[model samples]
Target: MMHSFGELVTKFTSYFNVRHFPMAPSTLYDPCEYFLGLGGKRIRPVMCLMGNELFDKITPDAYHVANAIELFHNFTLIHDDIMDKAPLRRGMQTVHTKFDEPTALLSGDVMMIQAYEYINKVRTNTIHRILTLFNKTAAQVCEGQQLDMDFEKKETVDLDDYIEMIGLKTSVLMAASLQLGAILGGAGDSNAKHLYEFGLNLGIAFQVQDDYLDAFGDPEKFGKQVGGDIVANKKTFLLIHALDVATGAQKEELQNLLKQNEDDKVEKVLAIYRSCGVDEWARSLKEKYVTVAFQHLEDIAVLSVRKKPLKELTSFLVQRDF
Candidate 1:
């Protein structure tokens, strides 16, 4: 993954940086540089490049599209961190935390605009299709974030709602990113749809795998604090599974813990989840979704050799520990 992406990152980072000027230091430019400089895995853009390469030769213009996705993703992250009141991201200070809330918000807006500028350079014929998908996806992502916040306030969330939330929040962008690449690469509508479905399924499985890692991953490999989800009373798969399988007292205990104020939140919720076999249930769900994702990828109707990297990407994602 890093092979092509390292060059793209260096190229685009320079491009974005040059667009920022030698104007004297101020609150305005700081957030832009801060968040961009903080850096991340740059996974979304790389996925875009890889998706394009699945059909056509790698193009420098593909880097622009990929950069657009990266900017948009980082924009979402800035806003999300603000909403989550998260202090850290990518193991560094969050944009909102490092600067102020207002700066973070403005910077995020600027990033979104910058993304549009990059996307505008896509071929004129494909621009309409690309923007249509991008706009719908951006809207869906906001809707997903709203649903996640709504989940925090809800007493009970159904499984369907949970699945839909993840689909919109995480999966849609992955689908869009791949679809954009395919669209630009001259793929027909049928192939684009297939690739989009492949990405969506992979994304759902990825989220499920993340949930499993929260409970079962090796700490060193997983990074950050394990069981952080339990501490927050976030309605992950484990919690939902425990809600269904837990006996009367177990359900009561879990609910009581959610309602309680204690430092042992992680320990208590994890104990309840273990008793209900919620971890195992979550692992099974993850595997099921991963299998479904792979099946979708396999059925894409592309030549086997052309599909190999995508399959490898899926394998790495579903089986990842960190």
Candidate 2:
């Protein structure tokens, strides 16, 4: 039976709500539970379930796979919070802040190890491939994070370099989630590859939209600090593309804005972004990647009807405020 992304989200949330850790070390397990309770959209795991249902009936194994994917995703978030020194996540205290860094680290470690245990529960014939993909994607995510940190120290980051970082940091895990689910659903190698490509492109588009929203969306609707990226001087689609296409005084003005720590910095930078048409470019870039993603989804050898949920999911992701 096929399921829309929303249906799969409800199904996955039930399984994900359980305590996956032991009760003993409250310092460790309590933080894990608290962070899990923060309750994200469950996008990655639900994508996994949707991938599975697209090819065959939903399997118990798919839930296990989804559990592992989500646990790992949250584990990354814990570490990301620590690295960013983020005090809040989902509008609550971050794991490191509420508990302590050491305890949060241990909690994240347990979550990651438990993710592997969930993976071990899957009885798919493609188990080895699943293990390999999971491990590789995990490392790529770390590599992307490292690159992002590295870029922060540099003066100028190439637009291409920035793209590579987001693809590694943001896109690979999402790509692997779909491929892993597809493999479990009896997808042949070619079809699985197409699905992976679909996810990779979709993830890039998602990041582009996220970066755009951080700069331009309503702080109330977007639920994030507007111009947060500019404040951090983070490398993003708009800033990087503005650097690439801007010229002479506009280019010089942007570089100076990047160096300034002032109340007017966001407005000044956004002025340049509008002048250079970076915001419009970001929308087009997001759509470009989403279009490519759906084309790959089309290449998957499933009945056309089976493709609807994925198409809807992609549309929802890219169409959000951009």
Once fitted onto the true fold, the runs of candidate 2 whose alpha carbons sit more than 4 angstroms away are: none
Off by over 4 Å in 1: 1-25, 261-263
Which pairs clash (backbone N, Cα, C closer than 3 Å) in model 2?
none
Clashes of each: 0, 0
TM-score, every prediction: 0.91, 0.97
lDDT by residue for model 2 over 171-271, one digit each (tens)? 99899998888888888989999999999999999999998998889888886779989988888988889988998899999888878889999989988
Question: What is residue 265's positional error in candidate 1, in angstroms?
Answer: 2.9
Instruction: Give candidate 1's error at residue 109 in angstroms.
Output: 0.5
Model 2 residue 267 CA deviation (Å) reads 1.5
Clashing pairs in 1: none
